[model samples]
Structures are given as C-alpha cells and as structure tokens.
Target: MRHVKDVTFHLLTHEDAVELLQFERAERAWFEQHIEARPECFYTLQGVAKHIIDCLALNAQRKMHPLIIRQRGVIVGRANLRNIADDHAWVGYRIAQGAGGRGVAQSALKHLLTEARCVYGVTQLEAVVAVDNAASQRVLAKGGFTAQKRLPGYSRVSGAPRDCWIFEYSPALSHGLAANNTLY
Candidate 1:
C-alpha cells in the first residue's frame, strides 16, 4: 500500500479477501438499511464475496483495478477503475457512511485520476452517479468531470430504477496533457 497524499490506496491481494469480506460485511450491515443505496450491496455475503473475488481476478489481468481507500490507517472507502475501454476506464467509488463530509472521497478521486493519467495511461475516465447523491456528484465535479447526459433508469437504487448523471473526464480536458504510458 502507498499513500496518495494523506490517503492510502492499496492493491488488493488474495490474502486481502477475508479482510475485504469483513469490511464489506460491516459496510453492508450499516448501509443496507439506509434510505437510498445501490442494489449491488443487497446480496448475501457469499454472493458479495464472489463478487469481490471476481473483481480481484479481473484486476489481476490489468484490465481493471480496485483499491481500498484508507485515511489515517483506517479503512474508509473503496474505489475502482472499472469497465476499461481503449485508452479509458470507468470509475466508481463509495465512502463509508461515517467517513463522508470530510472530503475523503474527493481526495481519493483526485489522486486516482492523477495516477490513472500518469501511471495507467488512461486518457479518459467516466462515472455514472445517482442523481440524488449530491456528495458523489460533487466529488466527480471537483475532479474535472463534466455531466455528459442523464440516463433514465440507469441503475437499480433501492430496488427502483433511478436516473443517473453521466460524467466524463479526459486528461486534455482535465489536466491539459495527454496520457504518457501505462504504468504496468
């Protein structure tokens, strides 16, 4: 694990599976019963663990990557560079409930975007955020992503199809430079 500014983003390993499962358990237990959320967390631990395993496997190929976000040595969030495209990757993130409002997600995202451009050769990145998640939308906006469109029924939030705001970022558009090369 290496620190990104004040936060640490760690490359997950098979040995992290158990700890990740435990983190997911606690996170789910706390967030599942909330007012609004993503449906992916509605599954049983067995299913969730399977999902994490699949993520880990995909990351192993360098086509995708997931990182656990920690602040001050405490697990606080998770983010992923998912659905990689030619010269691009889709990004998503979630901050623990108690960790919200402190700019943790924003800081993590800023660092991740820099790493993506400088280290991963990602020329473009995109994110789809639920319309009502103002905090997340703010994070993406702060990271230089602009709203591309509003897709109707883009995701299942709390078992209902919710509208999503699509955001896209390019190094030229964000940092005024092109991607150099892939870090790996």
Candidate 2:
C-alpha cells in the first residue's frame, strides 16, 4: 500500500472500480438506515457510485492523475486532479459514507494539493462543491482555499439544479501546505 504518512492513496484499477461500486452500495444502505431525515444531497447513491467508476475508467484510459484513499488497506475515499489547463486544474473528492469524520480526507487532499504545486507546477487549484456540503467546505478552508463565489444551479443533482460554492487556492501563497507526498 502506498502512503502519505499513515494514509494511503491507491491508483484506481478495474478491481478498484468494482470495489467502489460495492462501497456505493454500502453508502446507499446507509442512507436508508436513518429514517428520521435524509441529507439534502441525497440524490443518487448508485449514480454517484457509477460516476466514480466512470471517472476512474477515463482517468486510467487517459493516464490522468487520480487517487483512491485507503486506511489500513481498506477503501475509504477518492480525489482527482482533473480539467487541466495551463498551470491550473480542478479538484474533486468523495469520502465513503462510513469514512466521514476522519482525517483521511484532509490528509489525501493535502497530498494532492502539495503535489499539484511542487511537481506539476500548478499555480491555481479550484474546486466547486454543493453549497450544503459543509463538511467539504470546511475541508477546503482548512486546506487554505478561499471562496470565490457561489454559482447558481451549478450542478444538477437528482434532477434538480443546485447552487455550488466555488473555492480557489494558490500554491504560491500556501507553499507550506504539501510536502513529501508520492503519486499513486
């Protein structure tokens, strides 16, 4: 298992795709476990699971950089550096339902952000998250990203348009954020 300190980020493969889909199934089962209420972003457990598979398939085929997080060699989450453009790129992530609240997300993110800056010479890194996903918002904040704006109807989740928060960070400004991380 490859690692960044204690957290490991695996390169997604065909086997990884199957594992992610199962993880999605587990995540979906979680949504039903609580009958009191559901999260606002409760759109698609399966679709989102499929979405990750699609992303990994394309990433593998094109050799685009992507990483899947594992703790003690168990799948926990994923993050990708996509949409590359002239020293800038967009980033996105998903933490398995059962894996929330741990520092795994932040650790993987720090590794990615640091790698983008030092190895890829990325000057700007941006991310757009559903406005209601406060957990993600906090992650971006702790990683030194600042909100740029909110885009109305930026994402269509579960057939309804939803607003999203746009956040950006500059490696030139936060040079100390990432260090000694390996690419999966």
Candidate 3:
C-alpha cells in the first residue's frame, strides 16, 4: 500500500471484493460512457469475487498489478498495470464521478509509478486513452506520459469502434541517464 497526500493506493485483495463491487455498481453507468464497457457479469458479487481472485493470481505471477484508490478510507477509484511483458506494462485508471477534477488520478498515478519502479522494476509504461477523453489525457500528461501515436479503430466503446491515443512513459527518458547508465 502507498499513500499520497490524502489518497491511498492499495493492492486489491479477496477481502475487498464486496467494496469493489459496490463501487463498480455505483459507477457503472458513468464508467461505461467514459471508458470501455465492462462485461455484464463484472457488476455482480460472484464476478467481482472471481475478478479479485484472478487479479491476485496474476500478481503472484508478476503479470499484473491491480490496485484500489482510497481517500480518507473510502474507496474512490482504481488503477492498474496490466499486460506486463519484458520491462513494460500497460497503465489504466478510473476515478469516481464525484472524485473527478481533483488531481486524485494524477497523484495516484505518480505513486503507482514509484511502486512500479521499486517493486516491479518496470522501465517503461504505456497508456491508451480514448481520443475524446481529454481529462484522462491531461492526467497522463501530468504524470509525465507522452503521446506516441494515434491508433484508429483501436478499441470498442459502447459497441462502437473508437480511436485511441497511445502514450508512453520511460524513466530513462524523463530523467536523464547517469554516467553509470542507471535510471535516476
């Protein structure tokens, strides 16, 4: 677990299934409009239980890091590093509707990056944002991600093809390499 300001970034566990389910159910409609639509099963208790179990298994295999974001002990969002391969991972995040526009996502992402580097030894991170998600793009930029390319028909949102902006973050590129060839 990591704390940033008033927000806490925690690894999701089996015990958190109920809380996660409640949060997801509460934000389902809002999330579906802004992010990719989740499978219908994802909103159920059974599905969340299975999802948590799967996330824990993936973490044990060092293939993914699923996290929950909390503020003052209340679950407010989630962030994850998925599809990890080599030294890179794909970054994804979501903030509750009431929690938007407060720099929460940016701060949580910054903390996640630190854990990614120290714990996972990840050197590069990638994020894909829907072309119309200006807020998410801003958060990525605030967290030091740079847009690399635009992928057309990259994903489906609400069952329709959507364009996406690919962004990348590399510690070696953001922080100049030292004479010892080590990331700062």
TM-score for each of the candidates: 0.79, 0.72, 0.90
Residue range 79-162, candidate 1, lDDT tens digits: 888876568999877778888778788767876776676667886889888788777887777677878899998876457787
**Local accuracy of candidate 3 as per-residue lDDT tens digits, 1-184:** 1224578888998889999999999999999887788899988999999999998899899989999999889899999988887789988889999988887887777766876787888879999999999999987776777889999999888889999999988875555422222222
Regions more than 4 Å wrong, model 2: 1-6, 28-63, 172-184
Which has the higher TM-score value, candidate number 1 or candidate number 2?
1
The residue-level lDDT of candidate 2 at 158 comes to 58
TM-score: which candidate is best? Answer: 3
Candidate 1: misplaced stretches above 4 Å?
Answer: 1-6, 29-49, 175-184
- 1 versus 2: better lDDT goes to: 1
lDDT ranking of the models: 3, 1, 2
Residue 169 in candidate 2 has what lDDT? Answer: 79
Worst 10 residues of 2 by lDDT: 31-40
Query: Where is model 3 more than 4 Å wrong at Cα?
Result: 1-5, 176-184
Query: Model-by-model lDDT, in order?
Result: 0.71, 0.67, 0.83
lDDT of 3 at 20: 93
What is the Cα-based TM-score of model 2? Answer: 0.72
Query: How many residue pairs clash in each candidate at the backbone level?
Result: 0, 0, 0
